[model samples]
Target: MIHITRTLSIPDSEIQEQFIRASGPGGQNVNKVSSAVQLRFDVARSPSLPEAVRARLTVLAGRRINQEGILTIEAQRFRTQGRNRDDARVRLVELIRRATEVPELRRATKPTRASQRRRLESKQKHGDTKKQRRSVGPSDG
Candidate 1:
């Protein structure tokens, strides 16, 4: 079981991993060994996540989540399979932790009197500058 937090733990069965050939930093081992870890988590159908968490996870995942609702993460930074696998799990935990957080609601506020005055002052200043730049009339003293 992977513990995302004190309240949330995801079972190993929820995560599916595949080993594929990787193309970075392994020299000749890159050609011979399938060290890349392709981690798939079905956000839409996971029993571990609550409905709200699943929804947020899907949105957070963006392009990583496919049309079929599978979130795929490829970890191949390390040349060894064990490191790659651990990297993927860590990433998964981080993503889940992010999704678990509820964003603070925006408190609507009216413009302060001072702020409104400053804004109007700046606008008037800009208008005055533009007015001065315009060609003066011949009739003007």
Candidate 2:
């Protein structure tokens, strides 16, 4: 089981992993060994997540989640399959933990009187500067 938070724990059976050859760091060994780990988790069908968390997770997953609602994470930073696998799991847990937090609601706020005055003053100052740069006309004499 992978524990995301105090309340959220995902069973190990829910995760699927596939191994593929990684392109970097291993040199000759890279061509022979499968070091990259592809981890897939069904976010839509999972019974472990709450509805709100599931929705947020889908949004957070972005391009990682396909039409079937499976979140795919590829870990290839490490040369060893074990390290890559662990990295994938840790990333999944971190993503889920982020989704579990409730976002703070934003309250509507008006500009302060001082701020509004300052904005108007800046605009007027800008306009005055532009006006002074205009070519003088004979009628002004």
Candidate 3:
């Protein structure tokens, strides 16, 4: 079982892994051995995640989550398949850990009077600079 949070735990059965050739670094071994790990988890079907967590995970995953609601993570940092597999699992745990955290609600606050004054002051200064650069009228003489 993978523990996402105190309240949420995902079973091993839900995760699926696929092995494929890693694209970088390892020379002849890269061509011969499949070192990359592709970890797939179905966000829509996971019983472990709460509804709110699932919703946030979907948004966070962005393009990684397919239309079918599968979250795919690829790890190919290591030379050996075992290391790659471990890397993939670690990434999955980190992602779930992030998803499990509830974000603090932001309290809406209006701009302070001081801040407003400062903004206006800056604008006025900019306007005064521009005004000085303007061509003077013929009547100014």
Candidate 4:
């Protein structure tokens, strides 16, 4: 089981991992061994995630989540499969933890009267400065 928070935990069975050959650093070994880990979690069908968390996870996953709602995380930073697997799991946990957090509600606020007055005053002052910069017309009798 992967514990995201005290209240949130997901069973290990939920994660599916596939191994593929990684392209870097291993040299000859890279060609022979599959070191990259592809971790997939089905966000839409998961019973472990709450509805709100599931929604947030979908949004957070972005391009990683396909139409089938599978979130795919590729870990190839490490040359060894074990390290890459662990890295992928860690990233999934972090993402779930983030999704579990409740976002603060944004309250709509109006500008204070003093601030509004100041803004208008500043605009008027700027307009006056620009007017002063204009050349006087000959009709100024």
lDDT for each of the candidates?
A: 0.95, 0.96, 0.90, 0.95
Weakest ten-residue segment in model 1 by summed lDDT: 23-32
Model 1 steric clash pairs: none
Worst 10 residues of 3 by lDDT: 1-10
How do the residues 1-141 of candidate 3 rate in per-residue lDDT, one tens digit apiece? 877667778898999999999998988999999989999999999887889889989988889899999999999999999999988888788877887788999999999999999999999999999999999899987
Q: How much lDDT does candidate 2 score?
A: 0.96
Q: Which 10-residue window of candidate 4 scores lowest in summed lDDT?
A: 22-31
- Candidate 4 colliding pairs: none
lDDT of 1 by residue, 1-141 (tens): 999989999999999999999986778999999999999998888999998889999999999999999999999999899999999999999999999999999999999999999999999999999999999789985
- TM-score of each model, in listed order: 0.87, 0.89, 0.83, 0.88
Clashes of each: 0, 0, 0, 0
Assess the local accuracy of residue 81 in candidate 3 as a C-alpha lDDT between 0 and 100: 92
Put down candidate 4 lDDT per residue, 27-65, tens digits, no spaces. 898999999999999999999999999999999999999
Question: Could you tell which candidate, 2 or 3, scores higher by TM-score?
Answer: 2
Q: Top TM-score: which candidate number?
A: 2
RMSD, one per candidate, in order: 2.1, 1.9, 2.2, 2.1
Candidate No. with top lDDT: 2
